[model samples]
Target: MKKFILIVVFSFILAGIFTFINQPQAETVNRPSDKETSNLFESLQNELYEIYDIGAFKTASNPNYTINEIIIPINGSQEYYDSVKDEVESLVKNIIKTTSFKNYSVIVEKNKLDQFFNEKAKDEMDLRYEITKTVHDSLYEAYQNQIGDIGITDSAQQLIIEVNTFFNGQESNDFFKEMENKLNIIFQEKLSSNLLVKESSITIHIYNKYGERIN
Candidate 1:
């Protein structure tokens, strides 16, 4: 029927207009409408974004690892810590044993980093002490400065810089506690799935409200 053909042509025209109108808008929005936060998981991530304001925004839907460096509290377990301790220590020792200053590294360290961490120079426990010190230094900086607060990117920028420094070890511990409260389910699932790095250690750096490091 001629009427049927006319109806089909009109429908096609409507679709064409929608496609045209959305094309330019699509290019400008680096993200998507789905990127908006609604689920509890995304809401949680958004909270971190609000507080620390570090990494890019990811909805609960995006499981892509490169966009996310660390997940909170889920990785903050003592049992999890124990399982990975030997693994991390062994990796550190092997790297130091095989590599030298000429290795051309990224994490800047002016001191004799290799010799300081050499297994020949220090025993297993001592290596732990050294590693903890390094983690503490980095974690302290992150906590205080919020230098790279995972998904956080707006508020607490100035305050976190100061807070991460002044918060004592006790406070660092408490922060981990809160973090665990928020992301424990994800942390547990990741650990069970063995989704984290083989050589990494997820540490809990506690601090006092005063910004001093706690135990």
Candidate 2:
């Protein structure tokens, strides 16, 4: 059992973008300096923030954070929920600023049904689809876990107004909202034109420096 646990732990560590066991002790985080790191930060921030509606960002108090954190029974934990939402937005912005979609970009080509099989009569389509889903799931999970650690659950939206106000002022949030709306259209159009697939929603959650519930 111990060996099994150790192997599982090691596997996750090797697979993850950042190690949960090895983060800094406090907030004043050190920024990454390499070109790749810088580009990722900038792209992720730009892509994420510029894609949502103001209402979407306004406050998703009852947001779905199931992908990252465990949902507790107590629901009215406004501070907790609000904090989680705020952190998520903040991280979404930060991730937009940092990570590049090229890091996880996928090109899905819609081929004719005939292309899926070979002359040998082997069912290659089934195998390939499973592999694709598995890869997508893993990437989504890692993305979830990376930002999930700092999200505060059971919080409310007022927290967002507070933080955004403090950081860029309430009025700036309005401008961000406009940018978010335009971005939503642009990203959707871009996805439709390029990937030719429809993306329903792109949600995110953030965590503050403490790795605890911010609210």
Candidate 3:
């Protein structure tokens, strides 16, 4: 009887050991450190700048390891930004998917610079668009469709006119200055009826057929 009891006890002990050994271990999650998260965000910022030529920054995360918001500074016109905003957001999403913190909710948006501008410059934007359209149509007609493209960059504080002409070697500082003067005349004529053109700074860039900024 003693021998049988000892064998039974030994069998129970062996079974218990086996059961403990076969039980699944709890999963270990490797959460990123605060420094690591900051580094990741910095890397993302650099990549965005390199790819899109836009300087974007991150706001403080809600939690240390989770990125929740990204701000894209609007350095161009509303029209220009609207044209590329979707593509830029898509690129950011794709990049985030490749990162370890993909599970975090990330929201990308234009900074308050644009929001404030849009709110305050609605009339200005309409007027500017009209002026640019008029200028573009006139130039296209005068150049016999030789005007390759006319792009505007409105940073809410200044206007930059980027003109590309198919006329090779025709782009010079003198030509650019002449174009600027013409633009100023039109702007003044249009803006004189309403606002004083609070943002009076206008920049003009002329490009040759080869897409080189000659002026």
Candidate 4:
């Protein structure tokens, strides 16, 4: 009878072990791989590029980062910004939802574009200064050859053209006026083409990768 009881107890233990082994394991959430995240970012960026009103967009992402960064540069007016703000927000949110990121942000800077363009503008400004100087020198040479002795000095905003009062026994204020006008025209024409010129201003927008403005 004891042997029968022992056999029954052993069978019970084995049944319990089998039941435990057959039970389902807890499920785990699958996170996106680095390549997958990169693909998602590029896809979203391409969509953003297709938007007519958006001038430019940049994306930054990392698995360890809780929030992603996206910068969009805008050159539109306040009216334009108001019009497209909602649409941009909606589009970004939808794109983010398609990804594994649970939290993210979008940034829209007022007038910040790529660094390359900014550097180019600075280089152009320097070129403008050099070109303007050359034009002045050329004009000075022409004056000396035709009108007589003169002195040219560079000042902060104006070029001082000093004429000898006794040059060829005549004072020519007309020549100075002509030189000044010519220089002004050249400066205006060249500087107008500059993107950094304040006379023509552009607006920039900033946002996070999730499409929220940074304020």
Stretches of candidate 1 exceeding 4 Å from the true structure: 1-121, 145-165, 168-205, 209-215
Q: Point out the worst 10-residue segment of candidate 4 by lDDT.
A: 200-209
Off by over 4 Å in 4: 1-31, 53-64, 68-86, 110-130, 133-215
Error of 2 at 110 (Å): 26
lDDT scores for all predictions? 0.37, 0.34, 0.66, 0.54
Tens-place lDDT per residue, model 4, 1-215, is 99999999999999999999999974333456778768766866687766745765665555555446665555455666667776776677777775764345666544445445766777866754565455545555655444323334443444443333223323345644565566456446644464333233322222223433222
Off by over 4 Å in 3: 1-125, 170-173, 191-197
lDDT tens digits, residue span 1-215, model 2:
99999999998878774665576643222332367555654454465345421111111112232122111111223344454455444544444343332122221112223233332234434433333353334334433432221111222221111111112222344544543454345335433332112312332222233432223
The numbered model that scores best in lDDT is 3
> Which of the predicted structures, 2 or 3, would earn the higher lDDT when compared with the native?
3
TM-score of each: 0.18, 0.17, 0.37, 0.37
- Count of clashing residue pairs in every prediction: 33, 30, 0, 19
